[model samples]
Target: MELLYEEAGQPCFGLPSALATAYGGDLGFTTPCLYANFVTSIDGVVALGPEYPSSGSAISGREPADRFVMGLLRACADAVLIGAGTLRATPGHLWTPDHVCPQAAPDFAELRKKLGRAAQPQLVVVTASGDVPTEHPAVQSGATMATTANGARHLEGRLPAACTVFVAGERPVLRMTDVLAALHAHGHTTVLTEGGPHLIGSLISESLLDELFLTTSPVLAGRTDTARPGLIEGFELLPNRQAWTDLISARRRGSYLFLRYRLRSSCGLGLGLSAACRKRCPT
Candidate 1:
């Protein structure tokens, strides 16, 4: 891995020596920050439609650098969050550092130890309909499910003993703010979410996300009749709206481009919330 450029004043967690070397540079996040990680095709397609499962791996072709970066991000987070849809899409996946890049497992463990973090970052799954794959290995291994009251009722007695369930909101909607507040209250301030596009929409709709780590795979995923979602789904943020971001850093490994961006200060206000955005983004 090679770091092409990085902005000043970035947070530094003082990662383990081995991990830092492999990652091309140090990485860290501000306290209480909510960041996202995703790999997308050259054409900005993050998902190859719901019919094609494990779209991320396919997009990146399971590149070693991409996997290492994924593991590094997971290792740095206090908890790994995802929506039920993401879990369903990747049946056997585990949201852990070692699971993606076992070659760097020892370094990841060392990093966690130095930071006084848990053996593994806690896994958090969000759902509104309560329709989760309880048998998925990631869920079966252990996870914290945040869902609606109706969802909780539906999941009652179905989740494994290792899993913990929480009712985050009422039926029909589960606010990302409430979910994040709960996680923060539980001492998980440095959170990393790898949810699918739908979940990304929810977080961005509320202007909760702060940073994005994007990997541009050197392949084009042309869209056809099927629904192929980009990095942000469920809404449009162009022309009438804007999602301008500032480039924070850039790195590269082979043909893949690892880029980091800081979301604009608009707070992601939709047309309905434009008035509120004024107070959030005075400029």
Candidate 2:
């Protein structure tokens, strides 16, 4: 994959000069940062249909560049966050960077080592009902399951010992504020969410998402029905408060366009917390 637009050529991608400079280089976060990644059709449909269970793969047609980009983002994260639906949709899947792009495994591992990060980013699964597939391989491997107190009760002994269950709220509903604190407490400052729509909706509604990394696949899932979910779902941010974002970077490979947008502060959920939690946690 060649860079279409980065201005300065830098030493990256195991070469003296490489296209790695085109994409953002050396991503680091001292404070808690929440970002999301998604692949969507040019028409804005993120999922194809129920017919295609894993819609992202269908949406991107399993594009190698997309996979490489996914692996790259995963490499930079301290945790890979997803909803229970995403876990259910991606059966037998592992969130580690190498799992998605094995050819880049060494490079990804080297990047993490250079960044002083753990070998693999922790897997964080958000489930309100605790209705995750306990037998799924991803769940069996060490993961952090965030749910409500009632949900935690339902999941207590069902999950593997390797999985750490965090009860983020008293009620059955989850607040992104509490979730951020819990993750921060666990030393996950750079959080990446590969949402399943509703989760993205919740994060966006709470204004907690700091940035977004979206890949536009050159295809059309021309909305045959209302079931086709977009990049955001379950909520609307228009006609009253519209969340706006600024494009930070853009790159292309094949017909796919990779774009990064930094959500404006007015449109952001700015670490809204009580002074107590703010004092106890990293914002």
Whole-model lDDT per candidate:
0.85, 0.78
What's the C-alpha lDDT at position 204 in model 2?
85
Tens digit of lDDT per residue, candidate 1, span 1-283? 8899887767778888888888887887766678899999999899887788888999999999999999999998999999888988887899999999999999999999988889999999998877998899988898999988988889999999999988875546888888988888788888899978989988887888888999999999898799888888886777887777899899999899999998885334311123222222111
| Candidate 2 global CA lDDT score | 0.78
**True-vs-predicted CA distance for residue 265, candidate 1, Å:** 2.5
TM-score per prediction, in order, is 0.92, 0.87
**What TM-score would you give candidate 1 relative to the actual structure?**
0.92
Q: What is the lDDT of residue 69 in candidate 1?
A: 91
Give the candidate number with the greatest lDDT: 1
Runs off by more than 4 Å, candidate 2: 2-30, 266-269, 272-283
- With candidate 2 superimposed using the best TM-score fit, by how many Å does residue 33's alpha carbon deviate from the native? 0.9
